[model samples]
Target chain A: MGNVREAVDSGTWSLPQWADQPPDPDLTGASFLLISYGDSEAEAVVQQWEAGLRRTDLDPPVLRFHASAFDRDQLADKLAEARCGVRLMIAGGQYDVLQAMATARALGLETGEITRYATAYEDLPLFCPHCQTTSRAYAEVFDWTDCTGCHRVLTIKPHYSSQRGSFLGVDTR
Target chain B: MTDQRRLRVTEVRSLCPEIRQITLEPLEGTALMGFQPGSHLILHAGEHRNAYSLTGDGIMPSRYTVSVLKRNDDGGSAWLHQHLAPGSEITAEGPVSMFAPVHNQQHALLVAGGIGITPVLSHASALAALQKSAEVIYAYKPHRAAHVDQLREICHSAGFRLTEVTSAGNCRKALRDRMSDQPVGSHAYVCGPMSMLESFLEIGAAAGWPEYRLHLERFEAPELDPGEEFALRVSGSPEDLRVPVGVSILETLESAGYSVPNMCRQGVCGQCQISVRSAGSLEHRDYVLTEEEKAAGGSLMVCVSRGTDVEVAL
Candidate 1:
C-alpha cells in the first residue's frame, strides 16, 4: 500500500530524521538459531534470515531438521549454547520443532517455546519420551522454537518485529 | 493546516466464512478527503496494522472499505479475523499510497494470487467506473474457494476484463504471455506471497516494463533483530546520536530532525527507502522498489531494514 499522507499532499514531503551512518547488529552480541522442519524448508528460512541479517556481520546459527527427528537430547544441547549471547531460531511447520522444544523442557533442559493464546492446550498431554513430563509451555508462545526453560537469561532481542512475537521462547506459558 | 482526520470504522460486513468487508468512515468536519485508486489502509488492530487495499472509492462521505481474509498462518490475520466483528471500532489511519499503478496508461494489467486479489479488484473497479481499459488475472490455489463470485459479479457489471486461473494451469506462463502481448504503456501490478512477488518481478522486468510502471505489494512481515545499538550520523550534522537496538531507524531519524516521508511504518510502503551510496543488503518489505533495484543494494527501506555499519548518502 502507498502512503496516504503523500497521496493527499502531493508535494515535497520530509522523511523521519536519521544519521547517514549504518547500524550494526553484531555489536549487539547477536546470534540467531534458525530451525527449519526439513531441507526443503531450509531455503526460505535461510533467505529470510539472511536478508534480515544483512545489517549485521554476525550470522545467526541455524539448525534445520524435520520435526519428526526432534529428540529431547539434541534440543537440550542447542539450548545450552544460547546462554552466551542473543540467539534467534526459526522453526517451520508449527509442531515439529515446537513439540521438540516442549519435550526438551520436560527433560529439565532450557528449551522452551510458547503460544500467545491465554488458554490451555485442550488435548491430551504430549510428553517427551525421554523425560516423561507433560510439556505445558507450548500453550502460550504458539508454534515457535527456542530454549527458554531453566536458562540463566531470557533476553529478548530489542526492536524485533512483533510478527515473530508468537515465536518467542518465553516461559510464560 | 487544519487538523487532519483519523480513519474510523464506519461498517463491517462478513461476506463469507473468513472474508469480511470493513468500511472506515472519517469523522465529520475532518479533513480526510479520501484515498486514490489502488491505495490501501493500515488498520491499526494493535501493535501492528496489516495493510489492506482500498476496495471502495474513497469519494464516499469519508467511509473507506477494506476486505480482510483470515489466514490460519499469519498471526496478524488470525488476530484481526478472530477478534474483529461488526461495530467493533478501532483506530484507522492511512490510505497509504504504495504500489499504485501509474494512471493514463493504455493497458493496466493486474495479477493477483489468492487474497492478493483485493487491491487489484479495487483498481479494476475504479478503472471500469472511469471507462478506462484494464485486465485482471486472478490466480487461486485449487479448492481454496475464496469468495470470488462477488468479485466476478462486480467485474462483470463494470465491464472490465477478468481471468481466473485455477490449479490446473500455470499462472506464471499465462502472465508472461499476456504481458508480452500488451502494447507499450501497459503497467502491471502484483501483490502476493514474497516468492510469487519475486517471480513476477524477475519475469516482468525481463519482459521490459520501465522501472516506474511495475508496481508490487509484498505481504511478508518485517523481521527485526535488536542485538546491538549503534551511532547515527545525520547528513549536515555536527554531532552523532546513539541509536539503541530495537529502536527503528525512522524513529531515530525523526528524533534527530531529518524527517523522511513515511506512512504504514510496517515496511509495506516504499516511502522510507533511502538511496544508499554504499553496498549493503536491504530487508525489503515495501511495494515501492523493483526486484532489480532491490538487488543493486543501494536503496534500503529504513523503517525495518538495518545496515551493515556502512554509511550511505541518504
Candidate 2:
C-alpha cells in the first residue's frame, strides 16, 4: 500500500494515465464490482479478473454489469447494497468510463475503491476551456475536435480532471 | 512556514490528576480561522513546541480548547501545566489537519486511547455540528479518564452511544465487536498510542476494512530500535561518514553541516527521501515507504531508516 484513494479523490490524479496492467494489479476490497463497457477489450478485462478471484480460492461477493445494463438509480442501489470495501472497476471506452464515474462519485464512493481503465478512447466528455461548454469527443489523446459551444478547434490535453470526469481541451484555434 | 497566531489563555481547569483543559481566546483579533475537526495546533511557549489537538467545535469558534495530559517528563505538557495562566500570551501555529473525518462517510467509528481522546472529541463535535451520527469508543484508566461527561452529552444529541472502557482487554473486545458491525461506506478514525494504532490497523485490514476508510492520527512517533552503526555517502557530505548507534542518518548528516530536506524527522513524512546508489542492507523504519520500495533498495528515508555501507546519490 500506497494511498491510491487519497491521490484519486484529491484530483491530483488529474493527469490521465490508465493502469497499464489493470487486470493483473492487486485490486483489493471486501467485495468486487466490474462495470464493463461492452467492448471486447473491456470484457477481457472482467474475465481475467474473475479468473484471478477463482484462482485465489476466495469466493468474494462480486457484481458484474454492462455499462448500459442499468440506469444511474439501479447502479446506486447496487453500490449501496455492498459494504465499504467494494472495489469498483470500470473498463471501457473513455466515454462510458466517464459516464459511470459520475455515478460512482454521486454514490459517495470518493476513494481508490474505484479503479478505471479505458481500453478504447472514444466518446470522451471534453470540457472546452474557451467557452466552459462540455462536448462529447470521439477522439483520444493528441486528437482534435470542434467545441460544441464555441465551435473552436480544440486539442485534447493528456491532463485529466477527475473532479469533472472530462478531458481538458486547449483551444487549437 | 505557517503563520503564527497570538493567543491569550482565557481559562484553565484541571479535569483530572493527569488531565487539564485550557481555553484560549485571540490576543487581539475577534475570531480565529475555522479548522477541520481532529486537527492539531502547535503550542509555542518559550523554547518548547508541542502539538495538541483542538477539543471543541472547529467552526466559527469563539475560543479554542485543548486538553493536556500532564506527562512526567519535562516536555511541553509539563511546562504548560506549570506556567500557563489566564492572562498568559503565547504564539501558536496550525489547526493543521493530520486527522479529519471523511465527509462522505455513511457512519463514523471513532476510537480513542488514553490522552489520545483529544482529537476524537473534536471529531464528535464536528459530527454533531454536521448533524451526522457516530459511535465513539474510548479506553482509559479510570483514575485519569477524561471527558466522559462531555462525550456523553455530544453522543446523546448525535444519536449514538459512547462506549467507555477501563481495561485494555475490554477495549480490544469492544473494538473487535464494533468493527464487524459497521454499515457500508462507514469509516473508522483512530487516535491512540503507537501499539494501539498498530493493532487497530491490523484488525481493520483483517476484517476487510479498506485502508482509505480507516483514518489514523498518531500522537507519538513509533519507537525505532537503534541499529548497528553504518557509513554514509551523500552529495554534500564526506564519503564513508561514520554513523554511530542511537544516531539517525539524518541527524548525522546535519551534524556534518549538510542540510537535508526533511520534516517529521520521525520517518512518517517522505520529505527526507534520498536515492540509494547502493547499500549493504537498509533497515527501513519509515512509514512512508512501501515494502516493495524497501526491498528494491533504490531509495531511503534518512530521517529514521538506517543502512550499512550505503552510498547516497543525493
Candidate 3:
C-alpha cells in the first residue's frame, strides 16, 4: 500500500504492482469517485469527462465504468481489486486529487490513465460569492481578488470559447 | 492579497482510522494575517485540489487543521495515508473565506457529520473565542465515530454547547429538536454527507432558518441531468467534435492535443476559461463567472459547464 505512494511520486505503476494476476478488478472491488464539494460539481465534471470520451472516440465509453464517491477504505479496496491495471481516479483538488493520482500511478497502474484533474465548483455566476461586487477574473483576465464587496472568496471558471474566457461574477443574493 | 499567504505544515497526526489531522504554521519571515474563524484552505494534494477547513484561529501562531478520511474504493486516500509523512513539503493556498461566521446573529447552531466536522469545529471554536455561545450537533453513523477526545476537549475548553448523536434511529429527530430550540438570532452551519445535509436543510427550513443563515460546504458538487450528446467544435480545428451526454469538454479538447489551463477540475477555480463561440445553451457550473458574464453568453469555464446538444466552438 505504501509502495503505491512511492510509485506515484516516482511516476510508475505496473500491471502486477498491486494485484495477484489481475483478479476480477472491476467486480470484486468497487470503484469510487470521492468528490469534495458536492454532487453538482461531481456530476458536472463526470459529465464533461463522458463528453470527452465521445469526442476522442475512446472505445467502451468512460462513463460505462461510472463514477461514485468513495471513502478511504472503499477507495483502497477498489484499487487493490483493480489489479488488472490502474483505474482512472480523477481529482477534485490539487493536493487531494494528485495524491490519489500518484498512488494509482505507483501501484504499476498507468498514472496518467487512472487519474484526471477536474474542477470543484459551487453552482452559478462568476461573481465573488462573498463580496458580491468586484467582477471576478482569473490571473490573465483580471488580478484575482477575494472580493471588494463582501470579502467572500472567488474561484476561476473556464469558458469553452476564447474571448471573455472565464471571469468572475457577483452573487445575486 | 498581502493578507493571505501560504501556511506551512508544522505537524501531522493520525486522529483515527484513515483520518489525519494536519497542523499548519505560518512560514518564518512571512507576515501571515489571521484567518476568520471559519476559513478553509485549498490543499494542492498531488494532482487533485481539495478544500479543507482551518481548525485553528486565523491569527498567529497561525494554527490551521484539516482532517482526512480514507476512502475504501479509490486510490486517493491510500496515496495520502502512505505518502504524507512528516517533514514532507507541499504548498497550501489561502485561508479562504468560504466559511465565515455571521457576527450579527443572536444564536448560532452548528451541525457537522463525519469529516464534515472540520469547518464546524472551527466555527464552534470561533464562537467561543468571540465569547459567543453556539450549539453544535455532531451526527455520525453509530459504527464510524472519531475524534471524541479532541472534540470533547475543544467543546469543554471553549465553553460552547456540544451534543453527540450516535444512534441512527433518532438522528434526525434529535437534530430537529435541537434546531427548533434555538432563538431567532441563531445562524446554522451544516456540513456532512449529502443525505444528511439535505435532511438537515429540510428540517432547518421547516424550523424557519432563512436560506442565508444556513452556510454549506458540500463534500461533492451536485450532479446534473444528462441529455443528448452535443457538438463541441474546437476552435482552430476543422472537425466538429461530438461530446456525449456524460463526458467533459476539456478532455475532448485535450485528447486532440488542444491544451486548456486548469487546476482544480471540479469547477472551484476559473483556470480553464473558454468561450462558447456558438451553442444551443450552456449549463454553466464553474464558480468563476459573474452574473453579467453568464448572461452575456460571453465566457465560461470548460472544466465543468457543458452544453445542450448544440455546436459550442471552444
Candidate 4:
C-alpha cells in the first residue's frame, strides 16, 4: 500500500504490554472519567478500577459504557468538553479497545495519558494505505489479506499508526 | 572538529543574587538559524560545555539570551558568571531542541520551577505570538525571584494568565489547583528540577493526561551509581572491546574509531541510541527512551547507558 510497506519494514515494532502496571495514584482526582468495557470477563477489572477510585478522597464524574453501547455521537458530545485533566480507562477485547482508542484520539486524547487493560484478544483493526479502507483480521490468520476497498491482497505488517490509531495494511499483490 | 560559532556577549545583567542573564549576538552580523520555542544552546567555554535554554523569541531571534543560575560545584555556570562580560567572545554550538510545544492544541499550560523559567518563557512568548490561549505558572524561591518585573510585563502584554508561586507558602496545593482546571486539548510544558518535574509527571499521568501532551526538559542528568566494567561487541568489529569502570560507552566507541553521533552527552539527547542484539543486565541512564523501548531490549543510549556485557548493532 504505497510507501507504507517500506515504512513498516524499516520501523520498530512496539512490544505488547503483557502485564499491567499499577494505576496512577492521582487518577481519583480526575475531573472527568470515561470508561469502555466488553463482556463479563472485563467486569472484574472494572470493579478493581472502581475500588481503587473509592479509596481516593476526590470523587470525579465517571461515564461507564459497554463496547456495544459505544455510540460515537454520544461519546463525541460527552468529550466535547474534555480537557487536559480528564482521565480515561478502557477495558475490553482488542477490537473493542481499538475502536474506543480511535474515538479517544479523534478527541485529541493521547494514548500515554489513558489506561488500557485487554480482557480478551481480538482481530486488529487495520487501514489499507492503497485504497484507504479499514478492515479487521486476526494476527495469526495470515501475513496478508485482501483489502476491503481496493480488493487487492495486502500484507499485514507489525507497524502501528498513532494518527490512525490502527495497524497499517500494505499492498502485497 | 566541532561545528562551532563565535558569539559576542553584549550584556551581562544580574537577575538576582544567584542568577545572571547574559545576552549574546552572532559576531558575523547575519541572521542565525530560526529555532522553536523550547530550543537550547550548547556553550563551550574553557573546557566546559553546558546546555542553556534560549529565552529569546525563536521566530525572529536577533540575538540569544540565556539565564544562568550559578552553582558552587558547576564550573560552567561559575565560569560564565566570573569571566563572561560585555564584548567578550565565546564559542557555542546548536539551537538543538529536545522539548517543544504541541502546535495543534487549543490551549497551552507552562509550568516552571526555579531557573526552569528560561524555556517556559519562550513558550509563552511563542504562544502569544500565535494568538493561542496560554498560561504560565512559575514557582521560585522567594529570594530567587529575580525577573519578576520582566515576567509581569510579558504576561500583561501577551494577554495570557501568569501565576507566581513562592516556596514559603502552600505552593504545591496551588499548582495542583491550577492543573485541575486545564481544558481538554490543552498541553502542558514543564521544566526545572527533577523533583518538581517528577511531581508534575506523576500527578498529570494520574489525572489521565497523556504522556505525549506533557513535555519536559531537564537540566541535570539523573543520579546514577557508577557502573562496573563490561565487555561490548560492536557490529563490524573483530575483537571484543573492554569498557573500564569510569569510561563511558560513547568514549570507548569513539576512541575505538567509531563515529557515534551524539549531543548533550549528559543523557538528555537521544542521538547516540543504538540497537541491542544481545546483552546482560542493562543499566539505562538516559531520559529520552520510553519504558517500553527500554523493556523491549532493542535500543539503548550508548552515551550514558552501560551493561554487564552486550552485543550491539553499531
A-chain TM-score of every model: 0.37, 0.72, 0.36, 0.76
lDDT of 2 by residue, A34-61 (tens): 7787568788888777777767755677
- lDDT value for model 1: 0.55
DockQ of 2: 0.30
Report residue A118 deviation for candidate 4 (angstroms).
Answer: 15
Candidate numbers, best TM-score first, in rank order: 2, 4, 3, 1
Identify the superior model by lDDT, candidate 1 or candidate 2: 2
Query: Which prediction has the highest TM-score against the true structure?
Result: 2
Tens-place lDDT digits, model 3, residues B1-314 = 11224556667787766788776666677665567776767666666565667776555634667777777534445555666765665567776675677756555788888888887877776667677767788887655565656667767854467888875446698777876666434568877877777888787665545455567766665665554577777656678677777678877778877877665566654557786677678878865565678888766777678876444444
Model 2 chain B scores worst on lDDT over the 10 consecutive residues at B262-271
Model 1: per-residue Cα lDDT over B229-283, one tens digit each: 6655555556656656888777888887777866557666666777775533345
10 residues in a row with least lDDT, candidate 4 chain B: B167-176
Chain A TM-score of model 3 comes to 0.36
lDDT (Cα, tens digit) per residue for candidate 4, span B152-197: 7778855488888877244566567777777767888888888788
Better of 1 and 4 by TM-score: 4
- TM-scores of the models, in the given order? 0.51, 0.72, 0.54, 0.70
lDDT of 2 by residue, B229-275 (tens): 87888755555588899998888888877778765678764568889
Best by DockQ: 4
TM-score of model number 1: 0.51
